[model samples]
Target: MTFYVCIKRVGDILLSLTAIFILSPVLLVSALLLLCTGEHLVLYRQRRVGKNYRPFNIYKFVTMRSDSEKSGTITAKNDPRVLPVGRVLRKTKINELPQLFNILFGHMSVVGPRPLVRSEVDMYPEDLRQIVYADNQPGLTGMGSLFFRNEDDLLAATGKEPATAYREDIMPIKGALEAWYRDHKGFVVDCKIVVLTAWAVLHPGSAPVIESFRNAPGFPEKELTDYRTLLARTE
Candidate 1:
């Protein structure tokens, strides 16, 4: 295996195992809460396109009604389908923790382009497809994931149909960002992205001024400045 692939697999295994071990208690508590709130299902699995254009069931902690997608696939701000406990899980990203199992099972990576559904991947422009379809496993988090962390809010703010807004505005931007990550793939970049994700969650106002975001076509300008002023305090 190449150096990048070797380190990535090793890191994914070691880190995922360690995280699962350390967070066992948290996972247990979350599972119990999900059962109580969701009545039965604890894990939510959805088909996502992964490396080599293969499809796999991506797992997350159940946060919405089992049939919630009947209304729409895209979640909105204050989405009613979300259980009260699920809301907290989604906000804190505890819902995403189950993907550690994905990494361990070699279905995903610790960091890479976040996977999308078949409908979304089918919409990728040729230039974007070349990058995403290359030999890279989808990630638990990535550049697009971090940038679009508050995407539901943006959709709600615009009052646009969620799917239409995503197809016309959001998907294209996400494709470009994911393509950027593909071009810039490296160990250092992966580590930086993971750290930046945590930072973004804590400081939603401050988007990381990465090349991808700086060059993203049609990225919202006002959204960019949401937390730029906070830089003074950090510096």
Candidate 2:
């Protein structure tokens, strides 16, 4: 690995460990709540494509019914599979805290492209499929995660089937955003993404986050315009 890559890995370890230590109480409470509710499962582990196309199980607090995937993998606004407590967890993004462990274990980075299920990875434009995961480890959050922060709402606004809309619209944009991150990957950019992710949790739909990286490489302008139009309909 290059010097900066080594530094980033070290940073991921320190930050993830520190986060886990500081957030232990919240993590414990979230686990207990999940155990008592929603299929009585504490952690939900799903297989995801990680660095260099390696597959690993990603951890999250159980936020949906056990049988949720039978209906579809794509979750949209007010998805019925979501439990009552899940809404809070998902809304506050507490459900994803378990992924700190993924970062600590070196399966992911503090900032890079968010990992995707194998199927979702396949949905990327063929040209981008090899490019996205080849250079760096997948992340707990990244440009795609930030830009599509309200993805569930956006999918709902499409007025089309969730999976269909995602495949045709969101996936391509996500691929482009990930590609942008690949090109712009660096210490400062990663730090900015980490800050933006935290801000997104506190203030969803904040315009500053969108403005932060408006000049991303291969940014799909027409598609983004259509997405903004769709989001406007919901408001």
Candidate 3:
């Protein structure tokens, strides 16, 4: 690995360990709550496309019914599969805390493209598929996750079938965002993305995070316009 890559890996290990330590209480409570209610599952693991197109199990807290995938993998706004406690977890992003372990284990980074499921990966723009994750490990949070923070609601607002909207409209923009991150990947950029992710979680719908990257090369203009138009319809 290059010096930057080594440093990033080290940072991921240290930050993930620190986060797990600091958030142990929240993690414990979330786990206990899940185990006691909502189909009684704590952690949910599913295969996701990783660096170099490898498949690995990505971890998260169970925020939906055990049989949720049978209906569809694309979760919609007010999805019926979501449990009562799940809404809290998903809303506050506590459900994703288990992924700190994934970071610590070197399966992911602190900031990179958010990992996608096999089906979603297949939907990526054909040109972007090979290079999106070629150098960077999938992340717990990144540009795609940040900009599409309200993806469930956006999908609902599209008024098209969830899979169709995602395949046709969402993935193209998400793919471009991931490519942008790849082009700008570095220590400072990663730090900015990490802070922006936290900001998005704490202040959902308050502002557009994409504005923060107004000068970024390869900014997805048409996709973003379509995204905002759909978002406006939601309100």
Candidate 4:
């Protein structure tokens, strides 16, 4: 295993265990609520990219009706598949808890690239494919997740095809962040991203980097400031 991957395995396992211990009560309650509401599975899995250009199933709490991916991979915040409580979980960033196991398994990092679903993986550019696969391990959180944190809502607001926005706008930005991560990979930067991620989860309004991709150094951000303006004026 790679150095970070090995470290990730230990860290993720410990973190998963600790989180499970601390949150088991909430997990149980959440599970029962889902069951009572006929939500079925309390855990859900999907094919995601991981270290060395391989595919692995990623874990998440079941936040959507089963077969939620029967259509396409992009999730609009208003997606009918999202269960009521799922929305809260997703919004709170709690839905991603199960990924701790992925970290433990050494297939991911506490900070790295967000694992893309197989459906979305092809959207990555040819240049970035090798860059990501070199490390192969995905992350529980990463640069892409930080930048596109409001993506689902953006899609919902656009009323355009989610695929179009993803391919044209979101994926390009994601590619840029990944390239940055590839060039700047290190423990300290990972730490920064982790802290930034916590802030993002707690107060998404503080996402200054996401606000202006135009100034983000990598993305073609001319139109994004316009979106930011709309969000600010409306807010």
TM-score of each: 0.86, 0.94, 0.95, 0.83
lDDT of each: 0.78, 0.85, 0.87, 0.71
Cα lDDT tens digits, model 1, 84-130, are 88899998889999999999999999898888888777666656765
Off by over 4 Å in 3: 206-208
Off by over 4 Å in 1: 209-235
TM-score of 3: 0.95
Q: Give per-candidate clash totals.
A: 1, 0, 0, 4
Per-residue C-alpha lDDT of model 3 across residues 153-220, encoded as one tens digit per residue: 87888888889999887888888888888988888889888888878777777255767777666777
For 92-163, candidate 4 gives per-residue lDDT tens digits of: 777887787776666677777888876677887766666764654588888777766777866555556889
In candidate 1, the residue pairs with backbone N, CA or C atoms under 3 Å apart (3 or more residues apart, or in different chains) clash, namely 205-227
In model 3, the Cα lDDT at residue 112 comes to 87
Name the candidate that leads on lDDT. Answer: 3
**Which 10-residue window of candidate 3 scores lowest in summed lDDT?**
201-210
Of 1 and 2, the candidate ahead on lDDT is 2
| Residue 223's lDDT in candidate 2 | 55
